[model samples]
Target: MIPGMGAVATTFVAGVEAVRKGFATPIGSLTQMGTVRLGRRTESRAPKVNEFVPLAGLNDLVFTGWDIFEDDMYAAASNAGVLERALLDQVKPFLSSIQPRKAVFDHNYVKRLDGPNVKKGKNKMDLVEQVRQDIRDFKKSSGASRLVMIWCGSTETFIEQGPAHQSVKAFEKALTQNDESIAPSMIYAYASLSEGVPFGNGAPNLTVDVPAMHELSRRNEAPICGKDFKTGQTLIKTILAPGFKARLLGLSGWYSTNILGNRDGEVLDDPGSFKTKEESKLGVLEHILQPRLYPELYGNIFHKVRINYYPPRG
Candidate 1:
C-alpha cells in the first residue's frame, strides 16, 4: 500500500501494470531487472535478483493507496503527464478500477495541499486506528497474504525530535492528546508499524526516524527505514561525489536547483515544506564528503539547494 498517490506513485503503479502486460519495460526498478552474485567472481554465479531471492513477481502485486484527490490511478496518471496517454489507455480499465481510499492528511503539515477525501478523527490516536483499519480492510478485500506500506506523501514542515517523540509511552500519550509535534507522516508510520507492516518512506519527512517510531518498529517486528528515496539530484550526487572524493578534488561551492511542477512541487512551494526537503538534500554532501576528516577539500564548501514550483513544466 502507499500514501500520496500523486505523480511518482501513479506512474510507478501504471508502469508496473504495463510491464506486467509486456507493453513496456521496468527500466528504473531494480527488482525487475537487477542481478545478484551468489559467490566469488570466479564462480560466475550471478542470477537475476528476483530469481536468486524468493521475491514476489509482478503478477502478485495488488496496488492500492491513499490520495488527497479522488481521481483514480488512470486520471491521476493523466494529470501527472509523466507517461504517454496511449500507454495509459492500454491499462485504463486496470488503473481506473483502483480507486484511492481516503487519506490521513492535515493542511498544517503540508500548507499548500488539501482535498475533500480526507479522514476525520477525534484525535491523533483515532486517526491512527482509522488508518490501521484501512490496512486490514485492504488486506481482506484484496486477498493479499503479505503487505508493506510505502509512504510517498508530501514533505511535511520540518520538526525536531521533541518530548513527545522520546519514547513509545510518551508518543501514545501525545497521540491521545493530539500533540502538535506529531505530523501526519508519523501517524501513517505508526499505523503501519502497528499493523506489523514494513514501512518505507519515499519523501523527506521525519516519519520513521524518531525514537518512538523506532521502538514501535522493534516491538512490532516491522522493518522500517528511510528519510528519502535517493532519486533525481541525490542519485547524481551519490554517483559523482564519490568520484570527486577519490580524486581529492577541491570544491568551492555546489549549487543544485530543481524545477518541478507536480503535486509534490506545489506542496514544496510552501517554505515550511521546503525546509524539510532542504535538510534532506543538504545532508548528502556533508555525509558523503566527511568534511571534518577532509577539511581541505570539503570544509567550508558552499552548498545550496533550491526547488522551484513551475506547474507548466509538469
Candidate 2:
C-alpha cells in the first residue's frame, strides 16, 4: 500500500493506471520491462523477471493508504511535484476515486506536518488501536488477500534509540507511557505489523528500521527496508563517491544541495527533520569507502547536505 500518497506515490499510481490503460510504458521500474541474465554472457540467455517468478501482474496491485491530509490521490499526487500535469490529467478519475482514510499521527514526531484526516485519541496507545481498526476495515472493503504498508510521509525529527526501542514489549510499554522516542511512524509500523502486513519505509525517518520495529517485523514475518532514497542527486553522489574511493583519493569535505520548491523542502527546513535526513545521507560515504579501516586517508571528513525551498511559477 502507498501511504502519504504525495508526489512519488501519486505519480506512480497515475503512471501505473496509464500503463494499465495502454497509454504508456512502465519506465523507471526493472520488474516491468527489465531482463535478467542467466548462464554465460555469450550465451545470450537473458529472460524477463516476470517469466522466471510467480509474481503477480501489475493489474493485481490495488493501492490503498492513510494520509494525514484529506486530499484525493490525484490532488495529493499533483502536489507531490514529481510528475507532469498532462500525465496526472490522464489518470485523474482513477486518482480521484482513491481517497485517503484518516491517518494515525502525532504532531510531536512530525512537527512540520499537520492533517485534519487523522485519528484522535487521549493516549498514544489508543491511537495504535485505531490504526488496527483501519487496517481491518480496508482489508474487508478491498478484499485483498495480502496487504503492505509503505510510509511515504514527511520525515520526522531525529529520535535517539531508547528503552522503548529495545523490544516489542518495552516498545508497547513506551507507548503506554507515551515515550518520547516513540515517533508517529512507529505507530503505523506497529499497527501494520500487528495485522501481518509487510511495511515498506520510503522516508529517512527511523520508522521500521529500529530494533523494536525490526523485532516486530521478524515476529510477524514481514519484510522492510529504507533510509531515504538513492534517487536523483543522492543517487549520483553514490556513484561519484565510489570512484574517489577506488583511486584512494580522500574527500575532505563534499558539499551538496538541492534547490527544490515543494512541501518536502519546506518541511525539511526544520533542522530536526533535516538532521534525520542528513545523517541518513552521510552514511553513504564511509560505508562506501571503509574510512574506519583507513583512518590516515579517509577519516574526520565533513559532509554537508543542504536543501533550499523556493516558490515557482505554474
Identify the leading candidate in terms of lDDT: 1
User: Please, what are the lDDT tens digits per residue for candidate 2 over residues 1-314?
Assistant: 76676666777788889999888898777888888899999999998888877777888878887888899988887776567788778888989999998887777766777878988887778998988888888888888888888887778999878778888989888888888888888888888898888887787888877788888889889877777765755887889988988898876888888776556776787788888888888887878878888787778787788877675433
- Quote model 2's TM-score: 0.94
Task: Give the Å error, residue 64, model 2.
Answer: 1.2
After TM-score superposition, what is the CA distance of residue 106 in candidate 1 from its true location, in Å?
A: 0.8
Candidate 1 versus the native: TM-score?
A: 0.98
Error of 2 at 67 (Å): 1.5
Q: Given candidate 2, what's the lDDT at residue 25?
A: 92
- Against the unseen true structure, what C-alpha lDDT does each candidate score? 0.91, 0.81
Query: Model 1 over residues 1-314: C-alpha lDDT tens digits?
Result: 99989898988899989998999988977877898987899998888888888999999999899988899999998999999889999999999998999999999899998899999999999999999999999999999999999998889998988999999999999999999999999999999999999999999898888899999999999999887886888888999999999999979899988888888889889999999999999999999999999998899899999999998543
